[model samples]
Target: MSVVETLLVFAVIPLAIVLLFAVLTLLPGRAKKARYKPGQPWQYQPVWWEPHPLHGPAAGNHDDGPKAIGSSVYQEPQAIGSGHGSASHGATSHGSTSHGATAHGATSHGATAVGASAAQPAPVSAGPLGGARGTW
Candidate 1:
């Protein structure tokens, strides 16, 4: 065969086949679908599915209304020096002194240590709170 015919048979046919495949693969994705744009009112119907249909609002059980699920209530901020243990403040404990004994008064060497209270926790501190906060 001539050089021009051989080139056309090998290169041109394969390139045409590849271009045809690429166009066929990408054609379906080019079709437009419903899309949401910012500031535009949503036009689609909202759908909600509950695994337990009888317990949800769809079962005509609207007495309780829509209850907040896993919602947090707004709590009043406490004074920094209030010294009260509220939801926002955690109880701070001072140093705990425990000898070489377990909660059952048993020593490390299997001997009991009399008057040892390892089960009791350390007392909470009444001093001013101390912590640091920062932002970058």
Candidate 2:
């Protein structure tokens, strides 16, 4: 083979591989801590991002009552990167809202009743101690 062709095959090919290895090794690996869990309820983290209040205002699609959506009846404290959670956070009793059963509960801001219209899965509450509570 011609010297040019031989050098192109051996030298250029090895150089390409070395470059590839260096590039791959230096790439920023996944952050040791990422905030994403698909197929599960929206996991909340109290991470102080640029824009707080993480979500937009609750829409008008109130399922049980006009006060169900944005009402302060139930709101759970976000347990984000703090790595802190506890079971003592307690739960809201649906018996206060209706005679029926529900899947989850909350504090000042939460879903208390699963009205006949919202017969779907109720919101699941991750207890303050990093665990799912109730049927949800």
TM-score of each: 0.25, 0.22
Model 2 vs. true fold: TM: 0.22
Q: Which ten residues in a row have the lowest lDDT in candidate 1?
A: 84-93
lDDT of 2 by residue, 1-136 (tens): 9999999999999999999998898777646776565566666533211222224224322233222322223332343232211111222232323323321322232232223232223446777766567752
- As for model 1, its CA RMSD to the true structure in angstroms is 24.2
Error of 1 at 130 (Å): 32
The true-versus-predicted C-alpha distance at residue 97 of model 1, in Å, is: 79
For every candidate structure, what is the RMSD over all alpha carbons to the true structure, in angstroms? 24.2, 15.0
- Return the lDDT, model 2, position 96: 25
Residue 33 error, candidate 2, Å = 15
Return the top candidate by TM-score. 1
Give lDDT for model 1.
0.38
Candidate 1, residue 15: CA error in Å?
Answer: 0.8
Alpha-carbon local distance difference test for all models: 0.38, 0.38
